[model samples]
Target: MFEGLKVVVGLISFILVYRTVTGNCNKYLAFAICAIWLRFFLAAFHTITYPPLIVGFSINALGSISVACLGLLVIPTPVFTLKKFFPFFLFFVCIAISGFVNMKIPGTINVLVKWCYFLVLASALILSVRVQGQNATFKKLLVAFTMPVALQILSVVLGQAKATEADGSASYIGGYNHEAAFSMIIVSFIFVVGLIERGTLSFRTSLFTLSVFLLVLVNYRTSILTILPIAAVFYFTLAEQRLKPSQKAPVMMIVAMVLLSSFLALSFTMKERFADIGLLLSNLDLMLKAPIYFSDAERDIMSARVYIWSQYIDAFRNADLLNQLLGFGPDSWKGRFNLYAHNTFVSYIYEYGVLGVGSFVFVCISVLLNALTLKDRKLSKILALSFVGFLAMNMATMPLWNIEGLIFFAILNAVLIGHKKSSKSRQVSTDNRELLNAN
Candidate 1:
């Protein structure tokens, strides 16, 4: 069957990617590149589920294993301090306990295994870069991060160029699947901000701009709303720093021209969808009040998200003490609600419980604090801003456990936190050297 073939192909891909990572190549870069491909491309190929034994087998699972292995191979020692490791440990333990007590054995094991994989992989990535040195590691990571966006643009162009049906009706899935457009937009936004912070915008401006245009065309409204403001702020800030007064106007004009062209193109290609935006705006108040004031039919017009959220609230309120304190288990919401919570915080509370959710919040706070410590660094500030944006996006979207979101979050946090530690160490070394010289 095709399911078996998918598993076979995934294994082969994992092997090749693992070998590439372990080889003389830049291991961190190789892992980053492979992670992106596995998350966006290979994982999209198939989903194989046999239930209870192995719930889901996909390229993402294989990719996580390979990256974890690479991390273990490169660092051969514990790289995380207790402060950095405890929250995740507590969170994982809570999930395990919650699942076991709930008798959701299969889901508990699945959740634990996946979290273990993510933990090892994230830790390895941070330590691997530490061992490799920041300058070299950052350069490789930048290329690895940008490569997918570049390939995504190429895929979109090729897809657009392909001949359509005899009736001349074209399907506009473009580069990635339509379902994944929101995730692509988030990654692309991060890429643009990261490159700008690194001072490589001039070299990559056209490609990044094209990627952004395609992402907008894909038309995930929440993603557009979340990313655009952040992108604009970061872009203008970078422009101010990098452009001379004499050059700023021309650069700004070029940006405006490109944006206007993209808007016109979208308007022509997707007139109805654009009109729908206006319609939605007109009915915004009704949409907002639909859950309480309007009829069921009107609530359905809002795509049922508000209704679903209401159901989640009801479920939480009626949960047993154990479920309320710890949560049912990972993926356990489906058994009761027949769907995902569709909100990360809701999912966390429903699946991982209050303890797990609190641990996650603490981890996020720690990352923000670390970012703030590097206040003078523009990249750190931009990264902190991006993290906040990502967290906000999670409010309306359940991206916490998904492969693309996990990989993006892990890589960004690892790189930023690792850099912070390295900077501190360097400063301490310099101070010691100065003391010695003075003595």
Candidate 2:
């Protein structure tokens, strides 16, 4: 029964991607959005792979290709700017150099190819959004992105799907094969919250409520922590402008009650898993003083991540100059530690080196600053807040390399940057009109 459902869902997903790509007015943008959602289904089906060369073909590669092809076909005269392409260029060069130096032919080829695909996808998204309009494209992309997540939620509720183990223990999976599901939910929530703030979507929607429930089920502590402050800020912001004084008190009381009840319910249902967090917190002092290299017993208590991070730091310190500046190539960490760095920043540094990491950071900061300077201050604030949430989540897990999470990251950032560019163009046009009228 489960297998049949998976096949049905996968078929529908492919049809949707095909229809959106070929049928939409803005085919390039639609193709990109469709490809992003396609990752969700692909991951679920476990069909995305590159065989003996790279094992699993990433959603990044699939989505990138989809959008890149659309751009080539429809926008034969597509524009490219150094401001947009330079950072990616530097980062890819670093990876290629590192890969060649390391002599990991398969890994090197894989990294180079994936990075190129990502660059193409990013470029296509920005160009498509520029030719179209940001507001319309964003709304369409949001709807398309939400569909697979809704399906996933349904599958889990229907008992057609089960979580995969994160550690040796099964508790961390939270009913999905990868932790990226948790990140996806968080990103989706950010989008929903932005919509609510804009008055485009109602806060009381069933989908939003169900999403909140799924988030709690996922049991990602960092995401939970990030959501609290965002929720509070969102509520306070909205209440001041949108709510009556009488309505504010009751709304706050209701929210508090709901949160408290949810916490109590999770505490009882996930006692053992929650206890692991409590134990980790209780042993914080011991953890700091413990040896850099932990024993199996020590690792079990510390969740093995501390020891892994320590190993990564030591390896980086001990690497040769060229490797230190460029990195030891993609997936090189797996050779030494048998696992990827759980942290995104650490992973980037390990795989792409100081120069690559620097370029990536510069691009992020540039987009953020551009977002902040937007005339639509509300959306700008939401974008800025969402980026902060993304960064906070990245500190705990490496989502940039994960297919589903990378789709969310790439799409969200691309939309924001495209919107910023569009806004500037409008400002320039308005200024030109004013000058002509004065003349």
Best by lDDT: 2
RMSD of each: 6.9, 5.6
Q: Write the per-residue lDDT of candidate 1 for residues 1-439, one digit (tens) a residue.
A: 4334334544654565566566654544565546554554444343322112234544455555565566556533434442556666777788888788778887786666566556655664565455555545544444433323444444455554223233343433323343343354346445534534344444455545555665564455445445554465555565767788999898987776765675577567756434544554576554224235657655554345556666666666678887888887777876677667666787887777888788778878877777667744666666677677777667666665665566666666666645544454456333223322322
Score each candidate by Cα lDDT: 0.57, 0.58
For model 2 the local lDDT of residue 252 reads 74
Candidate 2: pairs in clash: 49-57
lDDT of 1: 0.57
TM-score of each: 0.72, 0.75
> What would the per-residue lDDT of candidate 2 be over residues 5-41, giving only the tens digit for each residue?
6567667766665665676547557656665665555
Candidate 2's TM-score reads 0.75
